[model samples]
Structures are given as C-alpha cells and as structure tokens.
Target: MTLKAYRTHFYKELEAFYPQEEYETFFKVLAQEYLKLAAYEIPLNFQLELDEAQRNLFDKALSRLQQNEPLQYIVASTEFYGFPFQLSPAVLIPRPETEELVDWIYTDFKNTSCTILDIGTGSGAIAVSLAKLLPEAKVTAIDVSEDALKIAEANASSNAVNVQFIKQDILDCQALDRSYDVIVSNPPYVRDLEKVEIKANVLNYEPHLALFVEDQNALIFYKKIAELAIQALQPNGILYFEINQYLSVETVGLLKNIGFSQVELRDDFAGKPRMIKAQH
Candidate 1:
C-alpha cells in the first residue's frame, strides 16, 4: 500500500482512541524508525509504497498504541538528556523534568572531579548522562530490580560511559558503602492518592515499584535517602531529587529536619516544583 493510503487508514482507526496530533506524531515516529524517512520527507513521499515487512510493523504498532502502550516502550528506546536509552516494562521511562535535575547537577559540577550516586537509577538516564558529561566524575547507580539494572547497565555501555551499577534496595540499607561528592535520586514519590491522575499508558505499563509510595508515608524514600546522605555525603556535598510537585513544601522540610542545609526547590520548564537540591 502507498504511504498516504496507510497514513489515512492509521488515523481513521486511532482517531477515537487518541488525539489527532498524537496519532500524527505516532506516524511520524514510525516513519523515522521503520521507513528511515524524516518527517519533512514524509510529506513529499506520499506516493511511496510500503513493502510487506513495513506494513506488518506499522499494523502491529497501531494495535499496541490502541491499547495505550507508551510509544517509547513500543519502540524499546527513548532519548534522555540528548542520549539514547533502552526502555522496557522493567524501568520507568525517563521524563523531561528529570533531565532538568541532571542539568542542574551538571551545571554545578561539570568542571570538577567528584563521586556521584544515582539511587533507583531506572534506565541509568541520570547516571549515564552525568558520566558522559563529566568524564572526570565517577558515577555509580543502584536499583533493587535486577531487570532494571540490566537495562541501565546496557544504557551505560551503549552511551560509552563507565558507570558502576549495583542492585540495592535503599530502604533496607543501614548505610552507604562509601561517601559520595554528590547523591541524587528520582525515587518513588507518587502517592497512592495520585494514581487517579496518571494516564493509562503510565499506570498500566510502567513499573509501579519505581513510581509509587503509600499516601500515609509518601516521604519514605526521601527520609531514608536523606538519613543515608547525612552520613554518605562528603562535607558540603549536594543531594538532588526529582520530586513530587504537590509535596514540595513537605520535601523541603524533610531535608531541613534531617540536617541537610541550604535546601532549594526548583521548577521545571512548566513551572511545576519538580526538583530539589540540598547540601550536607
């Protein structure tokens, strides 16, 4: 079938399930990946004919999209902080706000040598990016999920950066094995009460273990990490987190109560209070 004909059929089938713009985007992404055609070129290639393999790929992708699987998962990859990362149901897809968190750290420590740890480093997005950006810095990342760690380690290797990956459940640790010049995490901060606000793609496909906390104990990870950071950070070392926007005030207070000094909350580009940094 011709590209234009399939594009029309694709839209017609998914128009009820997704926004017009999004289905168009899905087409564009598939075109790039399966057709090896740029978005600009797609318009010029309406008459292009699809081979059997291309047709089957697009057909299967459309079926998955209808079920609300994330496009990144369908593609099995995503771009984080300008670096490509592999993704799966085992890891939470990296978000733009987390990119901001990485940028904030990079801006502060790009010129210096340091030790860094990324707690719950799903996909190793932050750890790998930092290692690539600050070649002088030593980066280590830990997660409790072995499957997630496998993806994270592959990301580090593919990105050609050296990062140490460890399987660790931070909440059970009595103390960190070694001190770090900087500690960062984008831990489970979504309260159970907030699940109603999550989209189906996220709620259904992403790893909940990396995404949720009980409403009654929403600050569990923050408190535990802060307690460990108190002992694990070098003097004046920094800690950063991609935080739950609604709990910014409580998160800041938690750090201060735990003896972390100079706690600062920062917003993402959308002006949500989505990140925090503190010093020990």
Candidate 2:
C-alpha cells in the first residue's frame, strides 16, 4: 500500500485514543522510526509503496498504538539528556523534568571529579548522562529490579559511559560500603491518591513499582534515601531529587530536618517545582 494510505489508516485507528495533533505526531514518528522517512519526506514519498517487511512492522506498531501502548515502548527506545536510550517495560520512560534534574547536577559538578551515586536508577538515564558529560566522575547506579538493571547496563554501554550498576532495595539496604560526593534519586514519589492526575499512557504502561508509593507515606523513598545519604555522603556532598511537584515543601523540609545545608527547590522549565538539591 502507498505510504499515504498507511498514514491515513494509522490516524483513523488511533483518533479516539489520542488528540488530532498527537495522532499526527505519532504517525510522523512511526514513519521515521520504521521507514526512515522524515516527516517532510512522507509527502515526497506519499505514493511510495511499502514492501512486505516494512508493512508488517508498521502494522504491528499501529495495532499496539491502538491499544494505548506508549510509542516509546513500541519502538523500545527513548532520548534522555539529548542522548538515545534503549528502554523496556521494566523502566520508566525518561522525562524532561528528570533531564532538568540531570542538568542541575551536570552543571554543578561539570568540572569536578566526584563520586556520584544514583539511587533507584531505572534506565540509568541520569547516571549514564553524568558519566558521559563528566568523564572524570565516578558513577554508580542502583535499582531493585534485575530487569531494570539490565536495561540500565545496556544504556551505559550504548552511551559509552562507564557506570556501576547495583541491584539492591534502597529501603532495606544498610550500607553502600563507600561514600559519594553526589547522591541523587528520582525514586517513587507519586501517591496513590494522585493517580487521577496522571496520564493514562503513564498509568497503564509504566511500572507501578517505579512510579508510586502509598498515599499515607508518599515520601517513603525520599525519607529512606535521605537517611542513608546522611550517613553515606561525604562531607559537603550534594543530594538531589526529582520530586513530585505538589510535595516540594515537604521534600525541602525533610532535607532541612536532616541537616542538609543550603537546601533549595528548583522549578522545571514549565515552572513547576520538580527538583530539589541539598548539601550535607
């Protein structure tokens, strides 16, 4: 079939599942990812015919899109901190706010060769980005799921950045056996009560273990990581978190209460307070 026909049908099938602009964007991405056709190239190749293999791949992706499966997962890749990362259901697709968090860290220590630890490092987006940007920095990342650690390992290798990947539950772990000059976590902070505010694409497709916590104790991961950092952080070390926008006050308060000096909450580009930094 002609490329135009495929595009038409792809939109028709997902029209109800996404907005008009979104469905169009999805088609453009599909064309680029599966056929190597740029968005503008789609017009130049409007009458181009799809061979059996290309058609089969596009058909399967279209079917998955109709079910509301995230296109990133269907493609099995995503970009973080301006770099491509392989992804799986075991990891949360990296987000722009998280990129902002990474930016803050990279900017702060861009010239230093500090030991950095990323707690609950799912896809290793932050850790691997740091390693690449600061080749001198020692980076270590941890995750509870072996599946996530596998993806993280792949990302580190593909990014050509060396990062130590460890499997351990932060809530249960006692010691990292060494101190870090930088400790960061973008751990589970979404509360059960806030589910309604989340998009269906995230709620349905992303791993809940990495996305949420109990409503009564939404800060569980942050608190536990902070307590551990208090003991594990080298003197004057920095602790950073990608926090829930609504819980910025509580997150800052927790860090301050832990005696982290110069605790600061920063807003994302959208002006939401989505990141915080504290010095131990």
Best by lDDT: 1
lDDT minimum window of 10 residues, candidate 1: 30-39
* Model 1: residue 202 alpha-carbon error in angstroms: 0.7
RMSD of each: 1.0, 1.3
Could you estimate the TM-score for every candidate? 0.98, 0.96
Please, what are the lDDT tens digits per residue for candidate 2 over residues 127-174? 999999899999999999999999999999998989999899999987
Clash totals, every prediction: 0, 0
Tens digits of per-residue lDDT, candidate 1, 193-220, equal 9999999999999999999999999999
Instruction: Give Cα distance to truth, residue 114, candidate 2, Å.
Output: 1.3
Task: Give lDDT for model 1.
Answer: 0.95
Off by over 4 Å in 2: none
Candidate 2, residue 91: the lDDT equals 96
Q: Once superposed on the true structure, which residue ranges of model 1 sit more than 4 Å away at CA?
A: none
